[model samples]
Structure formats: structure tokens, C-alpha cells
Target chain A: MLRIFIAITDNEPGVLDRLASTFRRRGFNIHSLTVSPTLDPAVSRFTLVTDLDDKAARAAKSFLERLVNIHSVADVTGTTPLLRDTVLLRVAATGATQAGLFQIANLFQAEVLDVGADSMVLAGSGSPERIEAFMTALRPYGLLEMGRTGAVAMQRCAAAASLETAVSF
Target chain B: MERPPQPPESASASASARAELPGAQIIWRCLEREGVDVVFGYPGGTILPTYDAMVDAKVRHVLARHEQGATHMADGYARASGRTGVVIATSGPGATNLVTGLATAMMDSVPLVAITGQVPSPLLGTDAFQEVDVTGVTIPITKHNYLVRDPRDIAPALREAFALARSGRPGPVLVDITKDAQTRAAVFDWEAAAPRRHLRHVPPPVPDDLLAKAAAMIQGSRRPLILAGHGITLSGAHRALAAFAEKAGIPVAATLLGLDAFPPGHPLFLGFMGMHGSPWTNLAIQEADLLIALGMRFDDRVTGDPATFAPHARKIHVEIDATEVGKNIPVDLALLGDLKDVLDRLEPRTPSLDTGAWLKDLDGMKALFDAPTWPRVRKGEGMSPVDVLKELQAQAPGAVMVSDVGQHQMWEAQVMRHQRPRTLITSGGLGTMGFALPAAIGAKIACPDAEVWAVAGDGGIQMNSQELMTLTQEGLKIGIAVLNNFNLGMVRQWQTHFYGDRRSASTLTISPDFPMLARAYGLRGALARTPGEAAAAIREARAADASTLIEFQVDPEASVYPLIPPGARIQDMIHEPPSQEAPC
Candidate 1:
């Protein structure tokens, strides 16, 4: 059961220590985590993917409920999302294999964002599940290089920032 | 400057000057607000200003021999008085020392407030001198923690710390404040207002539907039993448990920490159950048709084989922490709330004492109380732990007995009959080794006149044995009776049972010549080998001449028995008497 909640926060020294601390102290396991400052100069968002049981998950919610300054925690699993993510992957692109790779990308609605000799980059953004499924199909062609930007989800209908954030994170 | 003659408004001026202070002062003000009169602490470079300010603020500071002992004292204090214990220490080593104590408090649900002095603000990340991330070190152990970087957040941090410690599901809280914040002088308007918190609340009363469901279960059971845990005591509902037990005519067993929740001699009371528990209590719990577990988290020792334990019985668990409700051993009817409040509301609605068949079965088990199988006293040597505890009980009769981990702990738990709630203190969850001495110090602080005793093993005392100095410095007259078995009694028992007596690090030599240690701390000390010797030493300690320690030389192999080895079937137990060897 992997559930991710991305939190954006002010880049104070102890901020991440405190934010990540809530998870560590409560015995929650992190499956994957990515942290870096985005467009905001003084703020960084952490894409925290957690492997938590139902009770642990609820406890995680309660723990985060009282955090000091988290800007917002977005449960970006499923929603009409606006924020984008990039996974730069260069796979074997020999002439014979290139058509197969192109077909694979086209089938998954992925655009051929970049292509090079013996390699290609597939660019797409919707949800993590979409990117993951494409990555699984591409594995057979041998992914030569790989990079992934976690789901940087933004809510729809209004300014994405209008969604209530728990704290300055 | 043309002011009316300010008629010595110095005091008001002082109060007003402190009205807008930040971080460190914020914590201090919170302490003042919490009515903290005494603090146990040791200052290093990191915590100097807080120490200095505490002195000026008129908070009595007793320096501890070690940070570990300081927290234990606070744990003892909380157990004794139903108030949170406060311990202050410098960062790094100071914060690390508090981990085990905090873990122990969490396990037992004791309320504790630990304030650590951090390194200066600028040097926080470069592995600065005396700077260890105190919050990081204690993250897993504390109920919650705050790192105070901003001065304005101080008072609120403290308010939250204390509230978190003693609130729903009480545990330890640490407030790690930086040195710069401590020394910063600001307009210190400090109010320890915890009104900001909205999410945390005492669980509501057990619903009527739930109580009726539980009552129905009680009505249906043929051989029903009630097992009370520290939750009953924490909720201040021991009386409620008794009322329910008596009204329903059910037999009750207790966890180690649940001692005295039901009057020890009450007809409905069955002795404690676990690895070291009496045979009959274990047997009785096994035969129950319905089991009601209130406030107790069934630790592994209590439930030997989780799948097989109490198989025939339908279990009901009432716990405040949802984490504990179903973590181990399933509960048929699980209600989460404060024990006392839940039981009080449900008592009247429960059926009047009509389970005659069930009551009679437990009453028959109670007859086994007279025949305790253990190493008998070999006349005129020194005081047995049981006898010494009994004499201590006779004098302070209602005093809280705090114990260190070991054979002595089991003996005190068995012998000292506590007639009141929150009277017997032991590290049940963590089983921390050197808990008794400092805990007794805290216990004495909790109740100045209530006779407090530290019943410990020779090995258990040495772990934080340095607390003897803290006791003398604090000017507390606490009675200490060491059941000196010359080895770590519990560890030695394991070697005997499984490893064929191949002793390892369990045997401790160069024993703390306790009398010498006592005198070094400006206190009195004595050695006892016989029951009479124990009585005399206890009598002298009770005189309030000074804090005293009595070192008892007992047979080294005198193991605590009627042992139920872990994972073994209920009836398969070692009922052997301890080896009666010569005292060292």
C-alpha cells in the first residue's frame, strides 16, 4: 500500500528534519522520496511515498495535522492534476527497434520529446501510475538511461495555490 | 521623564519587562505556568543560560549524577503524584541519556517533560561542540517533540510539551531549545496557554450501546474474568474496576504495572499474571470463559503464545491508544476511552453479582495464595527482599514502591501489597535496569511524607547507581533495600534455564561497596543479611536522619520461579524453588 503526499515547505534548516521526523518517529516506512526546491526560491516540496498500513496511515495524517509550517500536502494519486513531471529515459533506438519504441510510446500517448542515435527520451505527465505503466512496457527494449521527477500535482478549477495547505512546508 | 513618584513599582516593572520574552523564556514561563517547583538537571556549555535563568526564577535545581537517572526520577515523580516529571539536560549526551527513560515512560504511559539545551544557533549543523540533534535522537521515544528555533514559539512549545505528556495516552515530551534562544533577552510576555490545540482530546465516554454489548457478554459467560492494566490506574478508575468486579462477581488478574488497582487481598483479586506470575493466576486466566482486559496492553510475557492464549475466552479490551487496541491478541469487544470514565459510567448498568459459579471457581484459586514456592529464609543472615518490603509496607503502609529491574523487582511486586492506585512504580514496558534509586528520589519528591522505597538488585542499582549522590543532594530521605544477588538476577535465570549455567557478562564483580558510596554522597548506609537486619535498617531509614541504602547479601542463584517460559504452554512451567546457596 503505497500512498504519497507531497508537501511544500519553507527551506529552513530544521524544516525537513521536523517534517520527515514525524514519519520516522512513528515507525512508518518510506518506499521512495524525492526532495528539491521547485519554482519557489525559499520553499522545497518533498514527494514522500510511504508504505503504511491503514492505522499507520491514519496516524501519519494525525501527525502531519499538527506540523509547524507545511505549505500544503497534496494527495496526488488521482485527480484532474495540473503540475507536471519529467522522466528522461534513453532506450536502445536502432532503426529496427526505433519503430517498436515509437509504437510503444504512441500507444501510451507519450510524445517523442527527444531522440538520438541508439537512444530516445519519452516525455509524459498525467499521474505516477501512467508513467509507471509506460516504464514497465519500455523495460523490454532495455532502458539505457533513466531519470524521474515525482508527481508534482496541482489541483484544478481555480489557482492551484488556493487549496488549503496545512503548514508552510 | 516627568513621571509621578513610582512608589517602588519595581516588581510590576519586572513583571512587565518579562511580558514579551521569546524562546527560552517562553519555556521558562510555561514551567512557571505549569506550577513546576523543582527540576532535576545538569548543565553543559549548551544549556548554561537556561540553567542560569532557572536559578534566578526560583526553580529548585537538583543536579543528577547522570542524565538517565534524571529522567527516571521524573518517571517516578509522575507515577507517584499523577503529574508530569521534568528533567533538563544539555544537548548531545544529555539528550541521548533521556532515550531509554522516555521509551520506558511511553511504554508505561507515564507523563514526562524533558528539556534539552542545544548548541548555539549558528553551529547547529557543523557537528558543533556538544551538539547532537536531540530531537532526532529521541524522535522514536517521545510522545512528541519540539525544536525551538524561533524565540516567539517558546511558551507555546512548552505548553504543548506538558499537555502532550499528561494528556490522552500520557507519554514523554521533549523541548529541545538552542543556546542562543536561551540567552536571548526579549520582551518576555509569557503565557503558557495550550488553548491553541484542538485536535487532542480525552476520548468520550464509552457509548451506551457499547456498554450494553459488553454487559451482555458478561451476562452470557459462565467462567468470566477481568484483567486490569495500568489504564485503570491512569484513568484514576481503579475504584471503578473494583466496583465493576465486585458488582459482577468476576475474578480479576493484573499486569505487573496494574498492582494494587484491585485491593491485593480482595476476594475477587487474582495475583498478577505473566512469566513471573503465580501459577494459579495463569491457570485461572486460561480457564476463563470470558476475559475483560482493561487498560492493559497484553505484552508477550502475559500472552505466552498469542494464538493459543485464552483461546476458550472471548476477550474485551478497553484502551485509550487506538494503536494498542488490536496490535496484539484480538479483542472481542474493543472500546477505546479513559478507563475510569468508561468503567464509572458502565458500573451501575452491569448486572448485579449473580455469577456464583464463576466466582466460586476463582475463589478456589485464591486458596493457593498461602503456599508460595521459593527459597525459604535461612535464619539470621540479612533481610529477604519480601520481608524488607513487608516491613517497609508496614511503616509507610500506603507509600509508593518504585523498583529497579531484576529479581528484586519481581520480589517487591509480589510482596509489597499496595492498597491504593498509583502506589507501585516499576518500568513494566521497558524493564529499564537502573530505574529504582532515581525513581524513588522522584517518588519522595512527589509525596514528601509518604515513605518511598527503592527496592533493587545489586546489578540493577549499579546501572545508574550514581543516583545515590542525587538523592543526598536533593535532601530526600528515601529508603533503599538492595536484594544483592551478586549477578544480574534476571539474566542469570535465562542462562540457567536454557544455556546450561554458562555465565557470561551477567556476573558483576567489584560490587559497589554501597556504604562507601553513601558516605561519599553525605548519606547513611547499612548492610543486612537477615530479616531482623532488614527491619532495623528500614527503621533507621524511616527515622529521617538521612537518605540511606541497605545492601543485602542474598544467595546468588536465588532465582524468581514459578516461571512460565516464553512460547511454552500454560501449565508447562518450572515450579522449582530457588537454589539455597550461601550468601556472598
Candidate 2:
């Protein structure tokens, strides 16, 4: 099963390397990872997607929390969190398929980022499942290139106080 | 990056007004504040500034022949004294040499702080002369690490490194400071650089309900066994372990690293448990109704095949590291806290249970399956390793015995009895060879009044034997025992048993005369060919004022018995051959 983990860590020089190395050293395969600054400048937030069973996911959470710079780790899998993934797709499109591609993009609420003679670039952001469906819908148009920003997550409700207090420590 | 402003009232006026010192001086000041009286290290170009400041520093420095030896010395010091050991080295190869030692400490959870000097800040990523990313290389091995480019970060980094090294599940931590950082002068305030109070993870109080549940299980168990581990020694929970065991009449089995945690001669003590453990102990584990694992992870060596390990037992795991709870074997209950604290709380709630029948059954198995009687002695044969170890144990029962990895190590664990904690120090987790010589030096330095001995196999002793000069120079009166079996005895034994008797390259056909090697290092040396000779050599070495080495030419074909083949169930142990020949 795929698991999602959100980790808050101190913004130190090698925090990213440490986190990534922790996964590698423990033989945990990370499917995707995205790291960015949190609201607090001194801390960074990491969203990691890995394939793990329930027990292993818990073990991974415990391991991550053991790192000195890591403030908190939450396994948000199956928690109905606001998970989002962004993707930029460059599809091969001539004059004949431009209108159809735009119509399909409109249905998924994707934005057209660039238009060229032989290809058009579209940007989309949504749940991971929705993004997968969007990519499948545009597959017939010949995807010239694609870039994904993995996944980022947050609790649906206003439970920011827990993370805020954890990071301040 | 600009330096952050220090809190105004963080330090007293006197502390704040102290003269500014170079970052190198700040390092020593921090060590002094941390109550470190000695450090094991070697000097190099990158770390020259720190070495120069040692003239004014109060800390005594012991120059090591190699960086790797220094780290092991520090590790041994920590294990023997229950204090955080410190090691310092230069960059590049010097830093890399500490890798094995760091990994060894990490595996066994020894408390160590390693300080390494890196290339100047600007030359860090440029791969300047003798430059390497020490922190990056050590990230996976260290509990925590720092790369300080600013002079002001030195004190805080050292303080935090020391704190983290000794806190929670203790392990080695590293601090890699750039040469410029060490050379630059900075204002040093001990109070201002104090580690944050919240940095330490305070384990939550053991849940009362869980404690009650564990107690109920203990009270209900008829065949309960306690698996004591190194954590008992680390947390000073030996008394608690004894109390808990005696209260319920439980038999205790210890892991290899946990040999000394429980007194060996105690009636309730079942000899060491694991691959090479006594057959009775392993069989009891297999037959137990309940297993209370205290302060010990269920290493694979202990549980040969997890699927068939303790097939009938319900296990309760008490560990300080949460990751170790279910990492190896699933447990019925996991109480996360220091072993001493958990044992203290659980003891009060525990109900005394009758285990008389179980104890009697285990004793029968022990008498039947323990060390078998050897055949009649042959006239011209060499000494057996077990006999040598037994003689040493009889002669110096209280001396700290540090054994190197291999056959002699297992034999030492088997024959020598330990009565107190911190008496038997060996490389258990990492199984690193050549750990005994230097680690014994460290142990002796930490406990100057105590007798220390390093026991190693012929192959293992040669790995770090150069440290004998360090012993002679430092005037440390330590005994060195070499079980010279003329081969890597453990590997040869495995070949004899598992690999169809293909001797391969395990034989040490060409090796140094260890006694002569010691003599060359300005120490007394002797060679013993028979059991009586071995005893006399040990006696003479013990009485000598200077360091001494005794090489016992042991039986090359003799193997450690009651061995569990890799991945084999505990019941399938290969015992000693019937009517084994005894040495002269």
C-alpha cells in the first residue's frame, strides 16, 4: 500500500540529505518526495510517499522522529487530508488537435502554459488520482514530456496548532 | 550568513566578560565544561590549531598510532566508565578512519563524541588538499552530526554533540569543523552556548495500565524467562533485573554484549543466549511460556529464525528506542522507557508466581546439554582455548576482559564468568575484529586502578597490535592474551561445518610471533604451548609491573560448540562431537 508522511524538520544544512539517507539506509523505497520551507523560516516541511504496510509505516514514522532535527512526523495516509500533486505536461498537438486538447484540459480545469506549432504545454494540480486520470485522458494526444511535483499534504481541518508548537521547539 | 544575536541575559557578567578565544580554544573549554578529563586522538595538519591549543587545555590527550584505534579506545572508555568518550582527528583519511569505529559504536549504542577538522570553509566543496565531506560520509552512522563553518557555532555544536551522544539510546555523534572555523577567534560564553533544554527527548511516563497488563502476564506465566541485554548495563538496571528475577524465581538469559549485566554465577542466571549460547538456554527460550525482553533488541543472532523463535511464548519488549520494538520479532506488549524506570514501576505491580517446575526442567536440560566432558588428555597436544580462558578467569576474576571478534571471542564469552557490570567489553553488534587491543587501552585508562586484559585470536590480535607501543608509552599495566590457533578459527569452523570442509583462505599460515611483537614494542612477552604453561604465563603477566603479552598456542582444529547454523531454529544446535580429545 502507498503511504504518505508529513515531516517538519529544522532548516539545517544537511537536513534533506539526512532525511533521504534515513530512508535509503533502512531499505525503504521512497516513491516521491517534496521539500519546501514551512511558514516558520527556521523549519522545513517534507512530504514523502513510500510503499509500506501499516506496521512498516509506523516504524518509519518512529525512525524519522528519532532524528535530532525532525520536530514531528505524521503518517497521514487514509486520513482524508488535503493532498495535492502538480504536473506539467507537454503534449504533441498540431492545428488539428489543439481545440480538442483545450476542451479536454478545460474539463479537468488545467491551464495551458505554452503553445507551439507541434506541441502545447498544460499545467494541472489536483489529488493524485485526479492527476492520474488527467494524464490518461491526454495520453491519446501524445505526451511529449512531463514533470511532476510529487505530492504535498495538509490536514483538512485547522489543526495547525500542533505543528506550529512542535516546530517552535 | 550573519551571526544570530545572542540572548542578552543568557550569561552572567563574569562569564560574558571572559576573554575572547579562538574556536580551537572554545572546543577545549566546551570539553572541560562537559567534564571530560581525557581524549584519545592524533594530530594532523587540518587539526593543528586545536593541537596547539592543547598546551593551555586541561584535558590529557593520548596520541594514537591510527585514527581507527583512537575511536575504539574512546568507545572502550565509554563502555567501561559509563561516560561519553571523545575522539578527535583531521580531515579526509583521518575522518574516514573513524567510520568503522563510529559504525561499531552506533551498532552497540555506545556513547561517543567525535571531533574532526575539515578543510577551510571556502575549500570545502572544491576538494582541496586532504578535504572530504566528513559529515556527509558519517550521516548514516552518527546519531547526529554538524558541519560548522562559523567560529561561533563551535561551542554550541560541541555541547549539543556531547548531549546527544549521551542522551536517549546513546550513540556516537560527530562535529566536523572547518580549519578556518577552528582558527578564527570568537567570543566564548559557556552559558550562552549551553545546549537547549528541550533538545533531549524525555520519554513519557510508563502507562500504568500497560504496566498492570505486563504484571498480569508475568504473574500468569508458568515458564517465564527474562532476556537481559546491554541496556541493563547502560541504564544501571542490574539491581532491578536481579530484584525482578528473584521476586518471581525467573531464569535470566543474557545476550553476548550483555554477558556481564547479570552475574554469571547467580543461580537464576542462564548462560549467554544466541547463536553460540549454551544449548540449554536456547532450548529454554524455545519452550518458555512468556519472554520478558528487557533493554535488548531481538537481534537475528538471538532469534535464529524469527518464524520459529519462541514459537509458544508471548513476548513483552521493554526498550528505550521505539524503532527496535517490532523491528525484529513481534511482541505481546511493548513498554517504551528506560529499562531501570520501567523495571522499577513494573516490579511493584508484579505478583509473585511459582516457577519451580520450570526451573527444575531447565536444570535437567542444562545438565544434559551443557559443555560435554572432554576425552582423556593427549601427551603432545597444544592448549585448548577454553582452558586458557578458564585459567585467566580463575587468576584475575575481577579484571576487565575485552575480547576481539572471532573464535576466541566466543570461547572467552563461554568460559569466563562475570560477576559485575562493565567487566566484559567486546565488539558484539558490529563484530569488528582488532577491537580488543585498543579498547582495552581505553578501558584501562578510564579505570586506572582496575586490572584490564585484552583477549584476541591470532588473526584479530594482529589487526591493531601496534597499540602495544601506546600501552608501553602510557605505562598502562594491561595483560594481552593471544589465542594463537594458526587460523581465522571461526571462519575455518564454519567451513568445516557448513561449506563442505573447504578450507579456502581462512588459514593463517603466515603470521607474526605475537609474543615477539610485544617484546619489540618494549613490553614483556611469553609463549605457552600447554595448559600448565598457559597458567604460568598468565600468572607471570599478572604479577609484572609493565604490560605483558601471553600467546597460548591453542588447538587449531577445536571449534566453539553448541552452534546454531545461520537461519536454523534454536533446537537444531550442533553440539560438540562425542569424546573430544583434550589437550596436554
**True interface contacts reproduced by each model, as a fraction?**
0.04, 0.52
| Candidate 1 structure quality by residue, lDDT tens digits, B1-584 | 11232223543565565555545556676787789877877788788877766655756677888998888988888898888899999998888888888899978999899999888777877898778887777766777777776554566678778877877888888898888777664444444344344233455677889988998888888888888888888888887888899888888899898986889989778777888787778888889889999999889878887877887999889888766766678788988788887788778878875777766766566565443443233333334556666677777777678888877788777777788887899999898988888888888988997877788888887888788878777777878878787788789878877677778899877686887777877888888777787778777777867888888777666666667888886777666633543322
Query: After TM-score superposition, what is the CA distance of residue B210 in candidate 1 from its true location, in Å?
Result: 1.5
The prediction achieving the highest DockQ against the true structure is 2
Pick out the ten consecutive residues of candidate 2 chain B with the lowest summed lDDT: B371-380
TM-scores for all candidates?
A: 0.86, 0.96
- Candidate 2: Cα lDDT at B407: 85
The fraction of reference A/B contacts recovered in model 2 reads 0.52
Model 1 spans > 4 angstroms off:
A1-29, A33-86, A94-103, A127-129, A149-169, B1-19, B186-195, B368-385, B394-396, B577-584
Using lDDT as the measure, the top candidate is: 2
| Candidate 2's TM-score | 0.96
Q: Which ten residues in a row have the lowest lDDT in candidate 1 chain B?
A: B1-10
lDDT per residue for candidate 2 within B27-73, as digits (tens), equals 99999999999999988989999999999999999999999999999
Report the number of clashing residue pairs per model: 26, 0
